[model samples]
Target chain A: AQSVSQHNHHVILSEAASLELGCNYSYGGTVNLFWYVQYPGQHLQLLLKYFSGDPLVKGIKGFEAEFIKSKFSFNLRKPSVQWSDTAEYFCAVNEGAAGNKLTFGGGTRVLVKP
Target chain B: SAVISQKPSRDICQRGTSLTIQCQVDSQVTMMFWYRQQPGQSLTLIATANQGSEATYESGFVIDKFPISRPNLTFSTLTVSNMSPEDSSIYLCSVPGQGRGYTFGSGTRLTVV
Candidate 1:
């Protein structure tokens, strides 16, 4: 079974601060990566995904993630975060032949203070 | 992307009871997924429901405890049976959307008292 590991469990930052969340997965074959965010009292929403092609993938709300195959990592980053960006972020990996079955990492709760 | 409407956004049920959560998708899909998100935890895939076929459950989940129904291409239901406090969590349904990404439902918050 594939496993995902997130380096941080909680993050606190002031508005306009740069943010980065580290994610790593253990899977040798082709894999699809995703970042999903959930605000308080809301459902999980896709932040970005890496299926193939360019390593850097841009997503909604000014978020982006870079897929590094050699490192087995797809880390989420933002140049500057806003208070509205406060949410719980999760990293998930889908094995190529797994047909959308996602293995998720323990989530990281990010709190951006205004 | 496809839109998903899930029923009983939240429910407080007594222990040993059962609760069935329904998910309806706006578009037809081949497979529907059920997931559980415990408090302060990440989402865990429970099973995959295929239209007209038996649902495939992940390890640690069973058909008896989390029975799933996929009666058609656009709808499915997950029933949590013999609920206990440990079963209290947010249950979500997902389907593969355009561009290969997955769309998630609003989620059903189940609390066993």
Candidate 2:
């Protein structure tokens, strides 16, 4: 069995502020990491993913994440956030051989103040 | 990526009733996944539907409660039988895309009264 842990349940920040959301997973096998964002009244959308190669992955909307294998972490970060970035973010892990099934973290609700 | 169209979008039903949500994909896929998102919670996989075969349910889910129909490679349906307030949530369908990504539907919001 695999599980994901998101360090923050909720985050609040002003516009132009830097943002970082911590995500960690527990799986002792080859894994694929992903970040998803769900805006208000919208469905979940893929932000970015890390399957192989360089640990640093960049996503749509100026978002990015770094996969640190030693720490078992895939934390999402943005140098500057806008009010439009307010949404609930989820971190998910797919076991390399688990038939594409994804295990998601609790989620972090980000509120960007204008 | 494949596009998924899911409906009704939303519905309100009385207790003990049932609601069947449908998903139609633009392309054929080997497996379609159904997920449940409870209030303020993350998504949980309910089952995996494959054409010409029975669905494989997750640990906490049962066939009787969450019946899935995968008649073909491009379409699937999930039925929440004998619904209760606990069954009220967002139901989504997903299919694996190119480059190992997954594309999701808009979701169905079911409310049991």
Candidate 3:
């Protein structure tokens, strides 16, 4: 079975700090990767996705993730995070050919202090 | 991306009661999924709602506990039967987006007491 792992369980940082959340997946075949964010008292929203082509994918809100197939990792990064970026982030994976059944990782809670 | 409308954004229910959550999509989609997110946990896929057929449940989730109805391409419902405090969580509905990504509904947070 496919699984995703987020190494960081909780991260606390001051504003303007560089952000990098590590995500690794266990899958042998082609896969689609995604990063999702959930604000306090809100629903999950897509931060970025990687299907094919370039490894670096930029998403809304100044978020970006790089898909490194050889490493089996798709890590999310932000040059500088703001206090508004405080949210829970989740990394998900789906078999490329399998419609959209996602396997998610334990989320990482980010607290950005202003 | 498709927009999803989920009803009863938050509900407080008594134990042993049942609650049905509804999800309506703005556009037709081939795949509709139901997921459960327990407190401090990742989202777990509950089942895949198939149009005109029985839903396919994932491991640890059974049809008896989570009955699903997918009548068409844009609508589905999931009913939690005989809920307990353990069932208190956020239930979300999702659909495949145009880019092979997913669009999720504003989850329904259930609290059973």
**Against the true structure, candidate 2 has what lDDT?**
0.96
Docking level of model 2: medium
TM-score (0 to 1) of chain B, per candidate? Answer: 0.99, 0.99, 0.98
For every model in order, the fraction of real contacts preserved is 0.66, 0.60, 0.74
lDDT of 1 by residue, A42-102 (tens): 8888999989999999999999999999999999999999999999999999999545788
State each candidate's clash count: 0, 0, 0
Clash pairs for candidate 1: none
Residue A62 lDDT in model 3? 99
Every model's DockQ: 0.67, 0.67, 0.75
lDDT at A3 for candidate 3?
89
lDDT of 2 by residue, A50-89 (tens): 9999999999999999999999999999999999999999
Backbone collision tally, model 1: 0
Give the lowest summed-lDDT range of ten residues in model 1 chain A.
A94-103
Q: Which residue runs of candidate 2 sit more than 4 Å off their true CA positions? A: none
Instruction: Record all residue pairs in model 2 with backbone atoms less than 3 Å apart, i.e. clashing.
Output: none
Ranking by TM-score: 2, 3, 1
Best by lDDT: 2
TM-score of each: 0.97, 0.98, 0.97
By summed lDDT, which 10 consecutive residues of candidate 1 chain B come out lowest? B95-104
